[model samples]
Target: MDKIRIKNLELFAKHGVFPEENALGQKFLVSADLYTDIRPAGLTDDLNASIDYGMVCHKIKDFLEQHTFRLLETAAEKLAWSLLTEIAGLKKVTLEIQKPWAPVGLPLETVSVRITRGWHTVYIALGSNLGEKETYLRNAVESLNQADGCRVEEVSEFLVTEPYGYTEQDDFLNGCLCLRTLLTPEELLALLHKLEQEAERKREIRWGPRTLDLDIIFYDDLVMDSRDLQIPHGDMQNRDFVLRPLAQIAPYVRHPILKKTVGGMLADLEHSQKI
Candidate 1:
């Protein structure tokens, strides 16, 4: 990842805990490292190929001036989100906000907050076996696209598949989608649960009938396991409903643990079933 650095750009903004600070405002120093691919810009000498630091500076200044926060942490968080969303071609950002004025009786050089934020590519599997299954799956896609900090990039055609663990139920309408999001794994899982609840999903039986079922299949090649959530879903490789649709959209995406592409895994599964 290449970076365009903007350092020590000063601005006056109303952002502090004290009421007097908001009323009178204060000097704040802002800095950012805009991360993106700079090869195209360097090779072609095209400014359009790269993010413009000048415009970004103005954006930062304008954002800080318009928003008021009692904490530097909150201000930095919102500013990082704003820059990542608004600035095209920016993949990651490290933002810093420094307040030089000390309200404390003790002398201090400056108090600052610095943080890094970026978009992460994630794969999600969707399934529904209850009434209006196709409608449920489609609505899930739309809802995710409309959600903040998330964007649906690609979707696979839905497939009608037999129930896996538990039989004697209607087949499932299953599909997968690629999502670009700013949410952490936990946050993403929470959003998925919320969407499932909205669709009236139930967890009465394991892998049984449901109005909607959402699973996190992959998150940027990350491997994590906890009581609450798992990344690179534990059983995705063995499930055709998950692999087939995921392969359609991301065949070359490799599993971090198994080191196999989606297409490769699907082929292996099909072969094993025949044997």
Candidate 2:
């Protein structure tokens, strides 16, 4: 990843805890490092292929002047999100907001807030075994697409599969999807739980029947294990339903820990089941 650096671009904005500070306004310095791949632009000598620092500077200035927030943290957070969301070809950003005039009256050179934010690629598995199974799966996809800071990039064809556990239940509609989001793993998990609850999912039994079941299969080739969640989905390599749909969308996506491609895992799983 390459960077386009913008430093100490001064602007006048009204943002403060004090009433007079908001009314009178103050001088603030803003800086940013825009991360992106500039190789294409460099090779072609094309400005369009690269992010324009000049345009980004204007964007930062306009955003600061237009929005009023009491805290520098809030301003930097919102500004970073705004730039990442609006800028084309921008993958990540490190933003800083420096306030030279402090109301604290302590002899301080400057007060500043700096933060980094970026988008992440995630893969999610979707399943439903009760109440219009297909409908639940489709609605879940739509819900994820409409969620803030999330974009559904690809979806595999839903397949009807026999229940894996608690086998007495009905067959499920299962599939996988690729998502581009700004949310962290935990935040994404929370959103999934919210959607599941909306569908009236209940976890009374292990692998119990449910109106909806959402699992995080992978998060940017990341490997993590916590009490509530597991990346690479602990049992994905053993579940045909998960791998079948996932491979359809991302056959070459490698598991972070196993270092095996989704397609290879699916093939291995299928071969073992036969033997």
Cα RMSD to the true fold for all candidates: 1.0, 1.4
**Each model's TM-score, in the order given?**
0.98, 0.95
Candidate 1, residue 84: the lDDT equals 89
After superposition, which runs of candidate 1 have C-alpha atoms over 4 Å from their true positions?
none
Candidate 1 structure lDDT: 0.95
| Local accuracy of candidate 1 as per-residue lDDT tens digits, 30-119 | 999999999999999999999989999999999999999999999999999999888899999998889999488788999889999999
Quote model 2's TM-score: 0.95
lDDT for each residue of candidate 2 in 195-260, tens digit (9 for 90 to 100): 999999998988879999999999997888899888979999999999999999999999988899
Candidate that scores best on lDDT:
1
- Model 2: CA > 4 A from native: none
Q: State each model's CA lDDT, in order.
A: 0.95, 0.94
Residue 38 Cα positional deviation in candidate 2, in Å, after optimal superposition: 1.2
